[model samples]
Target: MTNRLTKTLLALAVAFAMPAVSFAQDTCSNRGDLDEQYCDDNHDLTADTPTDPKKLKTPNTLVFTFTPVEDPAVYDKIFKPFTDYLSQCTAKKVVFFQVQSNAAEIEAMRSGRLHVGGFSPGPTNFAVNIAGAVPFAVIGDANGYQGYTLNVIVRKDSAIQTMEDLKGKKVAHTAPSSNSGHMAPVALFPALGVTPDKDYKVLFSGKHDQSILGVNSGDYDAAAVASDVFDRMVERGVISADNFRVIWSSEKFPTQDFAYAHDLEPNFRDKMLQCFYDYRFTDELKKAFAGADRFYPINYKKDFEMVRFVARSAGESFNRAAYDKQNAGKK
Candidate 1:
């Protein structure tokens, strides 16, 4: 089978693995949108650790994954140094698990095959609610967490000079769960007089690189993508900035979040967090991640409020049903 078909089939398989769940917790009065397996007795919008010692896990081997926005192999190499540090710091065998899609990453964590991961802004909500992810840090410099923007790009020769000009044109969105590629457009595009699905049909390219390449090859008239990904593409000479015109840009949004599964043994979890916060990135690593030198601390409920708001505005809840719908129709 072609790679595209394989990817679609894999996504569908993972989607089916996400069983139906009810968020109601008899113990917590306000569990918010968390899955039934989790509780938020403290009112924090995150999963609470299992109170029972038998339910907590302290594995000899720790599995790590990064958001599958780009090539997982590329990230596997990029994160090797940190994984080595993690192994030594935590005194365990650390392995990098290269997941092919956001759904697969979330499922790996949910099944305990993954111990910790870096989830993209849009999928972080899904990870938290459905996979018991507890976001604690994001890549940033000393100032704070780094941020990226949503950019709508079209070929310079294309007639689409404004967002309104995109009507009736083929547009590319990375994935339905992507913040810049999909959700942001659904929430913000109508204001610019170009509505997705109504004004034009969205083409799912699966990844930002695919969307960028699609627009460059004339497969798409325009694409909504993350600025950081666009910048990296330009830096890597995969595409030229002068060849593309950015018609619209949104306010800065926080970059991907690094979170751990909430069911880890408390002492092990604390040591792992410290290991992440203490390490400094190499120069190459910093350059690869837009100058982010360290994993700066953050609170998910506060740092991700804007992302959650955008999801809500688009009539989305990061629950199992949403995940299933997002993956079931993958193109």
Candidate 2:
């Protein structure tokens, strides 16, 4: 979903929004394309600053937000401690922001209000390119880097006993941009005799947790999701592991990413990275992490290459044109 989001330059007027600060409304010029409103800035794309810096300045109030991967309200509690730590570590007022859609999350960062954030599987590229976030760490344990597998799960009593048994049945994939939940299944399930959109009718469940719950409730015959998310659901007693079984699992794939904005001052940037690695998950956080205990260090070029390959295999190259197209229809 976050196509070439990495290289994106935020559209000036759209990306640099400053709240509580107003601009003059433009009256339409006759016969102009409705969408074609012209904007001219000094050589730099940023809005022309006020002659005196004070007029253009906004106080720095560090904002912390997370990915839109799950219900924001619930995860707000899960991440409370981290937000508190950011407040202490950065010595700036920090607030945890919850967003309901991909666009809101992107806009928050692009507008320069967002300081640090966690981005989900596909949208990290967009957060980076359009928002100027720099990737640093991902939640993981000492055993190895944090990762998830694409799992095909079914109700414990469902007659879908094998991957081959899923033929002609209804199946759910989280969304187009999801890796373990959608892309991986499409790229790897053919050998199982289930070619999505062909052998089976595919449904969009909107999220991995929903897909997992759907399988348990018989709303779906089978669904693909991130293994860690499924495990955490069981661990939370939100669902029982015994209620379902995995019929198929794909190669291990990268987990969620943690990032900071690229425009952050240098000294502040170093401290944020240190804080991420040093913050240990307490028991409750471990529960939220599905049993993970700490943040894992990663080198994007190496750890994420396999993910890039799988995405490409599924026809998503993570380029700008594709990202714009994906974002075009989104509200």
Candidate 3:
């Protein structure tokens, strides 16, 4: 089997591993969109902390990862300084887990192998609902939380100058669960006179960098990707701004969210959250993440309202059935 097929099979396997029925269905009065193993008693739309002490974890090591928006190795290096600081601050060994796909990352958290990580905006929904992820912070600076835009880009030499020009052309979307890469375009492009699957064939490049690189190499006639990822590539000299033109752009959306597993021991969870809140970004991290310098406080209920709106506008949900359906599409 090809590497792509292997990855798809792995994602499906993880999805199937999630329990179909709640273990504590008798206790949970509300679950919202969260999975069966989780509860949402506060109606915050995220999994609540387990009341059973036996279910709470206090690991000796904390596993951290960032969203797979680009090369995992790139972020592994970029995030090293912070992970080192986190280790000292939390008095625990911190391991930076490199995940190749969103599904793998979510599964790691759900399985209790991951302690804390940054999840991409789109997949944050699934992470919160299915993986018991509790979003608490976002990358930000003195101004506030940072945001990114969905940019439809094409080679400057390419004839596709407008959104409508993309009709019947090969266009790449980063992934099925990506916000800027796929969901935003599906919701916003129709009014602009371009529908993704209807106007052109939608191809999943699996990552924002791949989509941008594919467009650069003419493998794709156009690609919808996050502006921040595109900017980072140009800043790193991976690509030149002059070589590509953004045919269209959308409003700013929240960037990656730093979240922790909800099942962590309450005291340890608070301490870990404090460590994140108190930490500051290194100069290299600031440059790599568009000058963001700190993990700004946030809650999923308020911070993700716009994201939920976009998903709803596109007829998407964060439920397990939706996740399974999306994974099935990968096959």
Candidate 4:
């Protein structure tokens, strides 16, 4: 049933969606200081220069959202305090937008409809490349970030127990754009004597958390997921950490990233990124974040090296082409 549903969704996402390309610049005509290339300068390591810099106009209403990794409705409440704070900083009517799919989120940023939001670690590359999104900060501890690993897990008593044992078994991965959830395993599992979609059928469980739960419930033989999602599930009391055991874990990967539209007014970029660094986690923010207390500064060029490497190995070029290709199946 799980595999069938996943294939159905993949087929749907592929059929109706081709790929998203930045067709034109979302520039404003009446601006004096803004250049035609304002939408995207070469500062971002992702895309080519924008044709029109005038597209960098600030909206009267600053729209924001979180990474759509887990439940979307839950984060609307989780980010409310930050939304309230952003309104004060940008002097706009701030709203927490609960976007459904990664495609929609990219579209929002491209059309100047979305100002700032968070994209999960792997997908951040696409947002930067395809949607012209500028990544800023990430959730971190006192020294830096809350990094994660791609963990291969199975039930304690399951007959198949290791990455080597996963041959011909059912395994659940998250979205195609997911790193720890999909790309890591696809890149590494072959060395372990198993290959995804070849040795075992590849299934998209829609989310990392769902994949974890499916293993516990016997819906899948194993799952490849981000360590952070696994930890949060245990922290939320959805499942016991001990009930499951890790068979394999990849090298350290970067944490989730907070990004804004590339066309954001230059004057506001500093303030917005600063807002992410300055705002202390509110009581409710702390709860939504699963025990993480602060947002910290991270130089994307330096911090995202491992993430970029993993993405590249999966034939993901961190360009508009790869970004569009990955989301072509999502509705």
Query: Quick one: best lDDT, which candidate?
Result: 3
List the candidates ranked by TM-score, beginning with the highest. Answer: 3, 1, 4, 2
1 or 2, greater by TM-score: 1
> Which should have the higher lDDT, number 3 or number 4?
3
lDDT of 2 at 268: 66
Clashes of 4: 12
- Write down the RMSD of all candidates, one decimal each: 10.6, 11.6, 9.7, 12.4
116-182 in candidate 2: lDDT tens per residue? 7777766665555455455677888888767788888998888888888878998998877677777
Model 1 has a clash total of 0
Give the least accurate 10-residue stretch of model 2, judged by summed lDDT. Answer: 31-40
**Candidate 2 regions off by >4 Å?**
1-59
Each model's C-alpha lDDT?
0.90, 0.71, 0.91, 0.76
Q: Write the per-residue lDDT of candidate 1 for residues 2-100, one digit (tens) a residue.
A: 999999999998787655323222456656788878888887799999998999999999999899887888889988998998999999999999999
- Give every collision pair in model 3: none
Give the 10-residue window scoring lowest on summed lDDT in candidate 1. 18-27
- For model 3, the local distance difference test gives 0.91
Per-structure clash totals for the candidates: 0, 2, 0, 12
Question: Which stretches in model 3 have alpha-carbon errors above 4 Å?
Answer: 1-25, 329-331
lDDT of 4: 0.76
TM-score per candidate, in order? 0.90, 0.79, 0.91, 0.82
